[model samples]
Target: MELKKLLEQQSAEAWEKYIPSLSIDCVIFSFYENALHVLTVNMKDQNLWGLPGGYVQKDENVDDAAMRILKDRTGTENIYLQQFYTFGNLKRSESAFEAYDDSIWNKQRFVSIGYYALAEHSQVKLRIDQYSNAVEWKLIETLPEFMMDHRAIFDKALLTLREQLNNHPIGYNLLPEKFTMPELQKLYEAILGKKLNRGNFYRKILRYDILIKLDESRKGGAHKAPDLYSFDLTKYNEALKEGLKGNW
Candidate 1:
């Protein structure tokens, strides 16, 4: 069946199968080349950009709904998700959904649950969802004007990411399996939106004892190679459970 027909049929009966006033928005943060980027879509409105989002099914768990929407929109699954915040302000959904029927939407105020995720930038395969085009990552600092409260959502996500990096070992998911100390430090700096003294950062991270240094180094660079490190996944997993912060 054509996607348009399917959408119309679903909209006709959406109230029966989906929650009318609740939706989900995802802040997919991608870190690469020592910078933080966010996944934004044109949403058929070339002038306005927003986070990838969708309505929730009536029978769906919010977490499951987030995973479904992420996979459907990005063609990737099993990415880790963290529920960040819920935006319930009356004006949150003021922007118009031009492609959607007014009768199906605009019937009620919407409350959006925001989720943040971290995954290697290369693993993401962008796919066109129902209303997005030219989907791509935009630097967090240089994002275009957001359509709704998406900029607010991204800000909350970034703050959560910084907290998680400090309290959990989740940041490894955003880095290569084996990485140089500089690369790891840069990732944290990018997410934190600040620079740290190289020596202080290195010393602080090393005390965590969560990295397994390897003799191998980053190759093919003109500069002297820095020692490579692989995450001690065993310790990292334990840290995720017990927490790792302020021990330095």
Candidate 2:
């Protein structure tokens, strides 16, 4: 069967298995090549890209549904996920399915639960489900045209992430187990979308007391290898509870 036809058929089945007028959209983030990237999908027959998303099953809790959706796309259950916001602006997603019958589930007015997830870039195995032709990471700075109000959804997710930086442990899920101070700084800069003074960044991050300096340095560059460090998960979790003071 054709992809559109398959989607049309699923639209009928969706009403029976999933809650109507409710959906989940995930903004999965990763830090790679000194930039922040987001996972996106290209629909099979459309010239549009969108966040990886899915419907909420009638019997599942909303947070569980979001986790299931994230695992489906990223192939991991260990991602750091947060429920950031809800998007329900009028007609937010209805027009994307105008070519289909009004009864189509895709055409319904859905208020999406927004989630922001952080996964290590190397750990994620991007998967394309039945509805998408391509599932790939796009740099947050240079995203393709998005369908419906997905761009708005992405914008809001990014904003929420930035706001959380002051109080949250961000790089635990986004960075590798052992990373250089410069590398960690770059991740913070990527998320904050600004350049930070090296001295200030080092002092502030060290003061947080969430990282442990390893007895090693990164090897490869002609210049002196940078010192390596890893998060003290115990301290990190403690900081998460108490929240680090001050802002970027």
Candidate 3:
């Protein structure tokens, strides 16, 4: 059967199972190769890509639904997720369903709850659902055409992350358990879209007191081995609750 026909058949069932006119979209970010990337899926029969998303079930809490969706795509539940914004612009997602009848659940004007997530790149196991042809991480700087208003959604999520850097500690989820000071700084630089003074960055991060220097140093790099550090969960959690004191 054709994809649209298949969707039309499922439309009725979707309306019965989910809340009307509501959906969730996630911006899943990860750091790798000294760059930032976002998880995207290329929907079947469409040239454009979109953020990983799904409808909200009638009986499920919004936060739980978000967690469920993230877990379905990434194969992990240890991600750091935050609801950043809600997108309800007129005709935002309607054009994509233009071929379907008005009765089709997907044709409705959806009010999407936007969430931004951080996960370790190596830890994520990307999965593709029935509607998608490909599920992969795309570099933020070179994103392809995005479906509907997903580009706007992504831009807002990135801005929120950059703003949060001013007050909160980040990278516990994006980085490995043990990482070098330079790696940590590179992650920050990737998100902030700028370079930082190595000396100043080292001093400020140390002052934050969120990391513990491990005895071991990274091995086999061209340059001298740098010390490894891990987050002190207790202090990190404390900093998360009571906002950190300075800017980058």
Please list the C-alpha lDDT of all candidates, in the order they appear: 0.80, 0.88, 0.90
Kindly give the stretch of ten consecutive residues in candidate 1 with the minimal lDDT sum: 1-10
- TM-scores of the candidates in the order shown: 0.89, 0.95, 0.94
Give the per-residue lDDT of model 3 (tens digit) for 1-248.
Answer: 55688899899899899999999999999988877899999988865699999988999999999999999999999889999999999999999988889988989999999999998888899998888889999999999989999999999999998888745546787788899988899988888888999999999889989899999999997999999999998988777676666433
Candidate 2, superposed: residue stretches over 4 Å from native: 246-248
Please give, for residues 2-93, the per-residue lDDT of candidate 1 as tens digits: 43455566666776777889989999987787777889888653446889988888778889999998998778897878898999998677
Is candidate 2 or 3 superior in lDDT? 3
- Candidate 3, poorest ten consecutive residues by summed lDDT: 239-248
Sort order, TM-score high to low = 2, 3, 1
Deviation from native of the Cα of residue 104 in model 2, angstroms: 0.8
Q: Can you list the residue pairs that collide in candidate 3?
A: none
Which candidate order results from sorting by lDDT in descending order? Answer: 3, 2, 1
How much does candidate 1 score in TM-score?
0.89
